[model samples]
Target: MASSFHQFLLLLCCSVWYLTHISQSQSSPLPNALLLPITKDATTLQYVTKILHGTPLVPVNLVVNLGGPLLWTDCSSRFASSSSRSIPSRSIKCSREKAHDLGTKRTTCPSSAQPCEVSTENGITRMATRGELVEDIVAVGSIAGSKATVDQFVFSCAPTFLLNGLASGAKGMMGLGRTPIALPSQISTALGTQQKFTICLSSSDGILVSDQGPHDSVFGPEISRSVTYTPLFSLQEHSIGVKSIKINGNRLSLNASLLSSNGGTKLSTIVPYTTMESTIYATFIKAYIQAAASMNMTRVASVAPFGLCFSSKGIDSKQLSLKVPAIDLVLQSEMVKWRILGRNSMVRVNDEVMCLGFLDGGLNPMTSIVLGGYQLEDIVLQFDLGTSMLGFSPSLLMWERSCSDFKFDSWPKYSL
Candidate 1:
């Protein structure tokens, strides 16, 4: 089953690469980069974004999914747009062939004369419906300055049932996956920009910029000096080559094959934290505890999701961040590690307790390490489709700033 899941994941990502970006863009509506503000739910720790969609421009809250297939929203809302209209299935031919690849439940129109129907699924609950392929307006302020309104912005119109397990007030899911089905590729097709975007996430709210250049001010000195770029594994559930694990600069004794990105590790926004298989999780905990003993990090009763819990008593911490041992995810080489600091490595359960941000993914899970959103907070990630590289900056908090520092009310001079 695990092997099959890996095969399926690889297939999903592989399909994205061969498809053309501008298969559907008849004309350019908005030429500049698109900006979407992201917000994290306090309860779920999941990130969401708000967009002004439809004719009258009602605010639509959508969960940002790294591996989701397409942008889809609940059309059952009372504010369903006046200008929204369903289109024919043959016009764009988007996802028509890949519907079989999904292997999920779907609904389709019985006759060719009827409008196109789509199966919009909830990435969280997996609820699906034969939603309509509708076109409406999407208005947003661009990084190129001034607000722009996109006409005939196409998306799937799902029923209210697909909204289950979403963040409060969220009615849709905005897919940022690697394929043309995602926002970057869709915008690239329409606006003739690079099929790339940078997403900087804070604990609560973050920023998304499509086809944007680097902003040294927004990312600080670390972006130019310490940014690490890794070749992305084509999987929609994106994975990267993790050569080894290091705790406080000490390499852990582990099999190289176990840490392979081929099937062992993947990234996810849905999972609450970076998760490891039971055996690997045990080894990691042992190493962390051994390294932390000198710092007086006393082990306490394990938290429900987290295995390693330490008492906050006598420990130095400010707002759950401490100068703890750094957990490094060594990338292509020993020198190219993605250093995870205290703020990204540990979570404050309470004033009395703190826990490791990683979880255990059972004994024989499909993927060994599923990197989650908690570790991704306050970090800027640039997904470049042209180069097929994932550029990540060192934690923003390292420079005393967070992803929350970005001002979205207007455009800034982001250098190319």
Candidate 2:
């Protein structure tokens, strides 16, 4: 009896050890990887993420600009940081210094008298005054799981007036563009990881993941799955190659030349919904309306910014998704396609109205097709600079998972 009891206890101990080891291994990714939780402002519909910024570390909310020039914050009001004493902007002429960035510039933020000219992906121009330039510690990743810190992180401090059009809580912007000063480049260098970043924006909340790994997430031990790659047209713009678009397996008749042209299709976090040129929008809307009618979906009066709206009476509450037709963005070849199902293709404007989530950018839009944030939610996208490729996955909802389900969290309190 004594021998048998000892044997049972040993087996339980070994089992406990094995379980603990497995948990640790699954939570920690190979080499380096950090996840930053992001949020979407209901009023603005823009995705923003938080970070521990400055000395004495205060929470700062920043708008994620996938192609913006640099990471900037508004330090105009009630901005108190012991580390904000160093002045680097004017000495480095940051406004004129577009390319060269050391990634570690200690400085103080002084109010600027001049407002800098800033441009958006949608071809809108805005005036922004450059504030102070400072380098301090910035933390990313979840406090619960894992966190990575940059010892000497640098970012610009701008005036509060620049926060006019940003998400409700966002003070400024965090750039992930070609500039060396952007978050991707700085984090890539600081962590000694790959020169890439992955984005998985969810509705109201999301994540900004950097470095490389098949990260263990709430979706299981693999955050990277069902991923398909298409060559990136440009890193600066995060542009991708598109052969064509199909509505419910039926191809929309469009100018093939437009798909292969210079400014063909772009991925944007700025715009709320996908925007197309006048010709493309008209063609897409016509095909979608026809497809809806065939499905017996009710068409209601058009809403502002949305040319097509439908009644929720058409939606079958059961069986998961709406009966709407799927959209396929054929990329690289016919085999590789990004599928847009009901969750991504439709937006509930109200209890009675369900609007087709797309926009028309008048006649001459900068890029022919600007894929916006709404469609980007519940999908995983990797902007891999290492291979000049744009990797994407189909809707996560198909697996009964959301990108929001991925492991991520943040510090609760923040200032400005």
Candidate 3:
């Protein structure tokens, strides 16, 4: 019976040792491939292949040659960098909180006959102006003539960088034969990876002779009336495990499959946004410019030459011939709906409604239009004659388009 008890005790001790070894193996991090080579150099340190699963392991202490057990620590614990990133930047003034804070007295505003003097220099002084003040407001309207057309092209990244490194590929065609558009990097960065983007053409798709050379280089058959946008790069969203790509003005989230490339996983996915007709219009502005010029030749009632004065001071008046481009814009037939939201006491129209008004030609030489008594919810005004306009909301005069319906025949041209 004593001999049996001794054998049981010995077995129990062996079992305890085995269990303790197994528990330690489960708790400890996996060692590096070369850590236990059994012939490691005395001065070499063992490096782990993977990070431990729990909180960062406490840094081991090392001794200095001149000191007795000099202390060393991993700064990764106390001074580790964080993932949070924020930058102060100028964003669109869309928030109402910012607008209301700009305190301007109501009584000091303009009356009917006399234009109000606004505080210009320091908000203490004022400058009197004619008519009323205008504010920036956006609305959907039909475009006609050359303005209705747009050109779309995927510019090579090389040309894009040469013109302006900061500008996205959208503005690649701008300033081809003209002074280059001075695009700073800030503008490009502000357009954070756009899923898509749109660029407005300042020129038409036609041949013209300037001091430089032939303008025909910018025109092509592939140029369509719809807006053009190109995708550049992509990023992976950690939360969704999905990849996203930036095109001109849109973003496309996509699911991707990982495949092995060079023995490593290569993540690949399809682009979200595709070039479609309904989403884009490809046309040149020159087509409309020619149409408008042709209409002007037939519709002009009288031709008049007048002397334009440079200034009220020393400059002499120069004789200039001006042709007024007039069109019998179908008022009832060509009307677009204008919806405006009012504030304080400015609401004029309710909800969305049709605004049946003709766009008349303005006296400006370049291009201008006059809208007669057209009322939207946020905008209402009567016009006499001038370029600057005002709105009922914030009292500031602004130079804005008076016409909407833009028509186009074909795609416009552009150069890079």
Q: Per-residue lDDT of 1-416 in model 1, one digit per residue for the tens?
A: 99999999999887775454342221222335577777889987778887778778767778988877678888788485788877776555634423523543446544556676656678777677776777788766575455556676767878887887888888889887766556666677766678788888878768887754444434444454667899877556567888889998788888788777337567677777998887788889889999888666788998778888888787665433455778889888776778888888888889898899988888777777888889988888888878778888888776777888876435533210
The pairs that clash in candidate 2 are 86-107, 86-108, 87-107, 87-108, 109-132, 116-128
TM-score of every model versus the real structure: 0.83, 0.81, 0.12
Q: Give the TM-score of candidate 2.
A: 0.81
Residues 83-167, model 2: lDDT tens digits: 6544443444444434443332335553454322223221112564534565667877643455678877767766667777776
> lDDT of candidate 1 vs native?
0.74
Best by TM-score: 1
**Backbone clashes in model 1:** 1
Candidates in order have lDDT scores of: 0.74, 0.73, 0.18
Badly placed stretches (over 4 Å) of model 1 are 1-32, 90-101, 104-110, 128-130, 220-222, 261-264, 319-322, 408-416
Off by over 4 Å in 2: 1-32, 85-97, 100-125, 128-133, 142-146, 216-218, 221-223, 317-322, 408-416
Candidate 3, 280-310: lDDT as tens digits:
1011112223433453422222112111101
- Using lDDT as the measure, which candidate wins? 1
The 10 consecutive residues of candidate 2 with the worst lDDT sum are 116-125
For model 1, name the residue pairs that clash: 40-204
